[model samples]
Target chain A: MSDTGQHSHDHTPRPDQDGPPSYYQAMETAVRELLIEKGVVTAEEVRAAVEAMDARSPAQGARVVARAWSDPKFKARLLKDGSAACAELGIDMGPTHLVVVANGDKLHNVIVCTLCSCYPRFLIGLPPDWYKARAYRSRVVREPRAVLGEFGTEIPDDWEVRVHDSTADMRYMVLPRRPEGTEGWSEEQLAGLVTRDCMIGVTLPKSP
Target chain B: MTARFGPGDRVRVRWAHPPGHIRTPYYVRGKTGVIERICGSFRDPEELAYARDGQPERPLYRVHFDRRTLWPDDQGRAKDGVEVEIFEPWLEPADAAMEGGT
Candidate 1:
């Protein structure tokens, strides 16, 4: 699928933009300018980095998930060393140790960073706005079932819900269970069913 | 450096509230849990945040805590567990206190 994720939507000033730039935003700009001034990093390199980050989307993670669903060996490798498994797919997770958790019949896993909004940005791109919000960062760990419920994901009482707190150097991604009735489907077709939210452990991939 | 804790070993998080850029969450402070896995160590985040080279890296473990134990309420199920990445400095052998007495 060659579709760029940039969809046309009504552009408007965000609610948070009612005031001046945040202190952290100003600090980032100041540091970036100083780095460019000192020739530490070129302006072109900065632009390229941002370009690469934006170019990344959930499709990369979807491909990895689809491959894992199709290949058991690859899945095992993925569960063992998430960073290495992702590298095999040519997805570079720079300076981050990845931990991929698989969702099974009796187990469900969710990812959160109670300290901050730490996410596998290299594979899935930047996190959603809500993921960075204080409410999500705080409440998800305290009341995961209720938070999952808010996302319309209902975990059965008998099932085990595992919440992964990405509090350190390790980043996490959920390997969602494949939908049923999709036998004989190609990896490309299977990838189409995996959504961003599915990889985030907020919801499950629906059968098509 | 060799890891102090291994998988399935019961350990308790350090209860001290020293100020710094800490990765250990406030909720898991002083809680007891079993080590799930040894996620090879890296530079101390507390020092790294202050732009210092956190030399002599410490071992980091993925401690698995029961969700109900962290939050004792009817909202969470018994099977639910929360795994947090904690450095060696913030953890101690839970059985350390029970030993050398009996």
Candidate 2:
């Protein structure tokens, strides 16, 4: 047995965890604790809500996209009412409305929340860090093509690049056009090609 | 609730900026665009932000602004456009909206 207690290692704290919680973080903690103390919500309920949010992933949105590609009826419903269509597939979008925009050979759609980082969290889980950054929020609306180029996506010269600003009550998700050579493919097979970036309209799905 | 502006109706975003939880982007203010579709009525986010019940929901519309109208620079292609969700209160008929006036 080695004498492990003889020496102490001065370990550096994680850079992100070194400082105190941010203003919003502290406010959230205070409010949550007060709510729990007042019996408004239980700790278990809070934990369960967090777990539910974490459980949601890009896979859910991919499934919806795959289904839409396989079924025209679902695609129409998705375009008309994204929230209800998603609910038909058991993905509850909560209160925020979802707006699904389609991409085609002549038109490409990209989504950004200019006011804040509003996203289709229920369908595609939490948004990526870049989506929340001010650079993306401002630049995507001003110069979308350049922003897309930074993501390694190039918009054709003649093609139209439409940007959806998810301001106010609505959230947006881009329904990327199915890639070529995917004919007769099953929904499961198609789902694999639908990436989070594709749904966000930053990049296209890779062909298998 | 009935929508004031229907699809294809040209509308302009009100330029006035009140200090509150406003959802309209600054860039679109005073800019003219065609109403793409009615996005249904929803609670007023301006009031809802203050924990108040936004009584009598307001109609929302998806307004499509051409990139050229919004930005004069050569940023986007000619067909490029940007659509924003604007509450009914922030929009007025394009014909009725004039420079230096409401």
Candidate 3:
């Protein structure tokens, strides 16, 4: 069958200045009004919940994991049991437990939620749109080297690339090894090296 | 369910046709490897992301495949091999064991 040239766009319309409501605005209003009318949830409650959620950030957990990478004992603990180790670093694991896989010279680790976007949300916060996108989920496990290469990581032929499927119950976070140029770096400095791509094992932490 | 494969056991990821939303990566498909470690059972993320709960947890396994096996045509001066995690449902034992088990 020849490929069709059809494209599907689901853009939500934006409101014109002092004009009629946009498509998204209309839908949002309809849903909110329906909820209020049905007495399911109040409009005020929705606004309050959104505001409270916006107040928190994932930086707290990132800092803890970064520090642990610089500390030998903490690194050991992190590998032994990541959830409890994260707590020691002041990061809560919440309802989900996490397992930290360390990437080194011999083994390279990459994580994917084969069934969905089950990430270590307690520590990493919400995953980016790409993390939940179909392209990533379908491509990463099938072509890890290529996908990782697009993210600027080139796995050497000699080093084994291990893709960790984050299916079933456990979540995964990659604790990348400290870069050579970053010796004696402070926790704050080290945190800068911990990018989302690195945590996902698609890229390595940047060196000094 | 218990893992049918274990660390050092060679296996292959069963090919899966992607539809709607899926998390299995595209590169590691059809690659063969030795089981490196068992990462325990958990909820499948594809189902969880879509709020499809009540699905049974499946055992997760980490498989290590040689880089040469993945890219036979490449000529780079570096260590060879790649390790990937596969659910119990995605793997089948290889007909013959390759080197570097465990």
Residue A40, candidate 2: Cα error in Å is: 1.0
Residue A97: error of model 3 in Å? 2.7
Residues A39-80 of candidate 3: C-alpha lDDT, one tens digit per residue: 999889999977654543557555866777678898888887
Clashes of each: 0, 0, 39
Candidate with best TM-score: 2
What DockQ does each prediction reach against the true complex? 0.84, 0.84, 0.26
Please state what fraction of the native interface contacts candidate 1 reproduces. 0.93
True contacts kept of each: 0.93, 0.96, 0.49
Off by over 4 Å in 1: A1-20, B98-102
By DockQ, the best candidate is 1
Error of 3 at B70 (Å): 7.6
Q: What DockQ does model 3 achieve? A: 0.26
Range of the 10 consecutive residues with the lowest summed lDDT in candidate 1 chain B: B93-102
lDDT by residue for model 1 (A132-165), tens: 8999888878888899999999999999989899
- Writing each residue's lDDT as its tens digit, candidate 3 over B1-102 gives 777777788787766666654544555567787887787787776677688892798787867766567666655333444555567777777864333322
TM-score of each: 0.91, 0.93, 0.63
Tell me what TM-score chain A of model 2 achieves. Answer: 0.91
Docking class of 3: acceptable
Better of 1 and 2 by TM-score: 2
